[model samples]
Every structure is written in C-alpha cells, then in structure tokens.
Target: MKWMPFSFICLLALGGCQAVPSSLPYADPPPSQACYFPSAASSTLTASVDVLTEWGFSLDASDTRLGLLSASRERELHGASDLYASPHFSSRTSLSVFGGMGIGGRSHLGVGLGGGFGQLPIEVERVSLLWDNHHVRVSRDIRRFDQYGSLRTGRSASTDDFCARFQRALDANTATGDSPS
Candidate 1:
C-alpha cells in the first residue's frame, strides 16, 4: 500500500504547506482599497477587503473551475500588508497589499485567493488582484468634472466628496418624503 499520498496530505493539512507569493510588481500598498482588493483578490475576498477598509482602502472578485467555486468550497484567505506607502496623502498616492491563499496540494481540495493595489497620475488608483486567470481589479480615482481642471477643482471632487454626496442623498431621501413601510 502506498502511504505517500496520505503522508503528503497530512503534511499539507498540518500547516506544512508552502506559502503562495504575490502576483504584482508594485513596491507599495494600494492607495484605495476598493480598486486593489476587488481587482486582484480571488473570489473569497470580502473579509480581507473589510479589514483593508477598516485599515482604509480609499486609500483602497471571483473564480471557478479546479473546484474553486466560492459557493461550495472550503477555503481560507490570507492577506499581508506593509506600511510601505505611509498614511500620507498627495495629489496622488498609493497603498498596496497582497492577498491570496494556498489551495490544497495534490491531496487537499482547491483553495482560492489573491489581491493587489496600484495608483496612477497622482490621483487615479487601481488596487487589484488576479485569481488564476480572472481579472478582479478596480480603480478609484478622483472624479473629474472637467478635463481641464486645476488642482483646486480636482481636490474638490474626490472619493470623499462622492461619499459625502451619497450620504446626503441617502439622508435627504429618507429624512423627509420617503419611508419604507
């Protein structure tokens, strides 16, 4: 009887599995969380995204096959971060972090996970990840009202402004005339 397969499985299951490496080439954390985590992270990225958000991603999807289905698969997600980008803000800054998992080896079932972050043009940031061959990255840059705008105008319209606007819209909608029964 060949016990090799059983031994290999035991080793992997017992925390002897090798770690998975990051897929990006960036040297810092992603500037925004929404873009990076969503884009690069594998299917089960919510928890990591939440943590990054809690840590701040405004800085800040899925897979199948190989039985890596998010719906009915037993898996674990791991994430790592370095304060490479400092909590500083410029016209454009970036925060980058990597998230991924070591799916089971030859014996264990498939596990899926991945993530990454990147920013550009001193304002637009894309923090994303890739799962196997799928692209799940996203971008969160300052929304531009006019192409020929100055720093003042650009600063006035950022994710923060959008959030504030959204909040106001929600408040106005619920505060006065509309209430769900």
Candidate 2:
C-alpha cells in the first residue's frame, strides 16, 4: 500500500548507517627507542639496512653521515571490492495488466549487471633507524585500512626481531674492521 515505499527507504537508510566512534578513550602509544647495537653510526646504518632487507623490507631512504635509514614493506591482509568495473549486457522483461477497467495494460522492464573483484587489503610498514657514536636507535610504524576503507590508527611495529638481527649484522661488520676502536 502507501506505506511500502516509506518502509523501503527506511530499510536502506538503516542498512548503510555508519558506525559510531567508540566512547572509550584511546591513544596511540609513542614509538619505542632502543640502543641495541654498540657499533659506530656508519656501521650500524649498514647493519640496519642488511637486517631490513633480510626481513623483506626494501630500503626507502638512507643517510650515511647522519646515520639515518628508512625501509618499508607491504603484505596483503584482506580483500576489498573494486569500485570500478562494468559487466556484460543484462536484459529484463516485465508485463503487467491493470486491475481497473480504466487502464488497459502497463509494463516495466529493468536490467542490471555488475562485475568487479574487490581490491585486496594491503598493510604498509615503515621502519626508521638512527645511530650515534656508540649506539643505534630504531623505531617502526605500520599503517593499514579498516573494513570501511578508513585509515586506522598507525602504531609502532616490533623492534625485537630487528634488534636481534642488527646485533648479529653489526658484529659481523665490526669483525671485518668496519667498527671504530
């Protein structure tokens, strides 16, 4: 009856409603800094790059004199729908007969076709390194999108593995006479 159109509109509005922000207070923790290597800045930077590459990250930036380095990697985490794409032709046919004697016949035809694969979710990672005369400092940040395609909070990634591997790499470099006495 007359209420049918109103009900359909309400259903669509409710179904597409956006999620509310949580009332619970939350904050991203500060990036962790650690002096895990006891090698000269240059040597530490080299070792850091090696560790990063070994862990599947490519070198994004580096400064030998400043003892700074950055690396990043990507991984697919989820699937997302592609917003662009078109499907093959689709045909719909409909015929209707009016109940009243005033109207003879009415017809409506609707055809819809859509096709596309959702884009896969990708996690982006970035790692930064800094070193001084006696120690090396490292920090990491990871970025990812939520199901709604909204950029979620970015937080520091684990430095434990990097620290361990960097230590070994620095030790090797020093053994080859790369470290300062």
lDDT by residue (tens digit), candidate 2, 98-161: 2323433865555553422344446788877777788766677788764335565577664666
Which sections of candidate 1 miss by over 4 Å?
1-43, 58-122, 132-181
Off by over 4 Å in 2: 1-27, 32-37, 79-117, 146-150, 158-162, 172-181
Task: Give a tens-digit lDDT track for model 1, residues 21-127.
Answer: 76855423333332322122232344323333443343223333431212111111112122222232222223334334555554444443322232221233223
- Report the lDDT of model 1 for residue 23: 83
lDDT of 2: 0.62
Error of 1 at 67 (Å): 13
* Cα-based TM-score, every candidate: 0.18, 0.52
Best by TM-score: 2
**Consecutive 10-residue window with the lowest summed lDDT within model 2:** 83-92
